[model samples]
Target: MMKILVVDDDPNILELVNIHLSQAGYTVMKALNGFEALKLVEEDFPDLAVVDVMMPGMDGFTLTKKLRTEADIPVLLLTAKGELEDKEKGFLAGSDDYVVKPFEPKELLFRIHAILRRYDKAVDLFIQAGPMNINRQSYEVSVGKKVLLLPLKEFELLSVLASKPNYVFTREILIERVWGYDYEGDEQTLNVHIKRLRDKLEKLTAEVIISTVRGVGYKLEVSSS
Candidate 1:
């Protein structure tokens, strides 16, 4: 079971997060403040942390910064401060994501799941190709700091192809690797995904795009455009 730590000064919020997370089948731990949360980390690291920004001692920003500097753990900052500056500071402090106060529990749950999925799959959690940075754990693909939205299959396809730049992957190999050989879909499905991935990459002004080799498969290349 995955362990999740929830840090908040408000008893009600802590309770709510704990109940929902527990029901979601995670081992949920609670800390009323950042200090307690850090102490807990010393004993056993949680898979991910949902931290409130305001606390009596060791605010979430400080705690997040410390964790990022030392442990590379993922953090989601939950706070009422929704200003652009506040969000920027959270990112600068090493927060992986930020949620404002009074957020829908389901939204929180989804975000948590995405972040955890990224980390649980890959310990390094990030892949880079040209100007693109794909964060496997965060489910994020970015050019520099700007994140690009991608559909699930498209994202997976991009990851596979970008994992080895300029290396041709046969259609049979791609389907077997990405959709699985057992995938009952048409072989044409791979082409559709490739087209969409190419369009999205172009829209993002990515320096790389998928290049198809006639009678063969495809590879990602650094484009001059």
Candidate 2:
């Protein structure tokens, strides 16, 4: 069974979430604070984490930031603060999704399942194209002799394209697959991410690998050289 860690200081909230998650057939781990959450992460990494933004010590933002540094575990931030800035902060802290307080249990379950599904689909079995090598298990991508450290989204995007080299994928399709249906962001977000990926890949080879199809989408160039 997939394991999920839920971090919240509210006893009632913890118990309620635990019951719902259990019903959904997940192994749930509970932590009342960030310290405990960190410990739980160190001991055993969960498939995903549900974190409350407001806590006594070490708020959700800090914990999420710390977690992102070590693992790419999907994080869903549950918070009473519904301000736009608060949501932005959660995203900046590496949360994969955010949910406000007083949310329905059914909605929460759906979000959890969706995030897991998206994460699972983001990576392929493996990708070997040209001089590049990708290991889905370790989430590593290398170019020729050099190992490149790519951000999670960038790596996933490349993996998707490289999985089927030369296949053109529309920007909308790429955004939906990479960012999830629940993603509430502008299309410019995808553009920026693609640019970042291009910058990183350019360091490895002078020739560009990702090609824009102009008003259609993008595809990995099948090098003739």
Candidate 3:
């Protein structure tokens, strides 16, 4: 499911978006200010964030700019400011879209869809396997409270395995899926990548294990106990 973070000082707006967005089948999290939102980003990486432009400590513009340096997730600014200059400044601050206050919820959703179409990955932008949360769009994976910075190939390999937990992926299948059909590397290549991936994953949690099926491929298995 695509997770969305709603950052607004107004409790009413937060509740409204939570109720409506959650009803729309999206996981919703809220923060009354930008600091909380930033902390949540480290905890749970959302596919998109709806931020209000005016707040106490960190306004939406500043927050959006800060987020740009943090993650690749899309940011949509919600504010009463409708001036073209303000919109330009918002865009300059790295907001994907701006929704003026008193806007229709349907319109908000529509705008969100437009942003997703432009910025998000495939429809399934997120994946959860055991304690690991993966965001395809942001290319971010969090294992429990720790956010891992994995290399490209390692990230893709983990994403492939995590997509279907405990399902054995044959060596050939893993190569085809992760490295592509015309991969010039041999099975040894897969082994090397798996070792690196295992090292990183183990650093996060030893409870999460990647098992190698002899003569087959690999499967991600996590302990329940």
Candidate 1 lDDT over 1-225, as tens digits, reads 468889999999999999767644467889999888888989988888999998887989999998778777899999897899999999999898988999987678768867876776323357788888888777899986678878888988888787777877778657755675457888799999999998888887658989998998898897654
Scored by lDDT, model 3 comes in at 0.82
When summed lDDT is taken over every stretch of 10 residues in candidate 2, the lowest stretch is 121-130
Clashing residue pairs in candidate 2 are none
Q: What is the lDDT for 146 in model 2?
A: 80
- Candidate models: Cα lDDT each: 0.82, 0.82, 0.82
Q: What is candidate 3's lDDT per residue for 1-225, written digit by digit as tens? A: 568899999999999988766544467989999999999999989888999999999999999998887797799999897999889989999999989998877667667767876864425668888778888878888976799888888887888787667777778657755676568877888899999988888888876789998987798897764
Residue 36, model 3: Cα distance from true site in angstroms: 0.6
Winner by TM-score between candidate 3 and candidate 1: 3
Query: What tens-digit string does per-residue lDDT give for candidate 2 at 1-225?
Result: 478999999999999999877644467999999999999999998889999999987999998898777777789999897899999999999998988899988678778878988888323467788878889778877876788878888887887677667767778657656776567888898888888988888887654388899987888875745
**Reference-based lDDT, residue 105, model 2:** 82
User: What ranges in model 2 sit over 4 Å off?
Assistant: 121-225
Q: For each candidate, C-alpha RMSD in Å?
A: 14.5, 12.7, 12.6
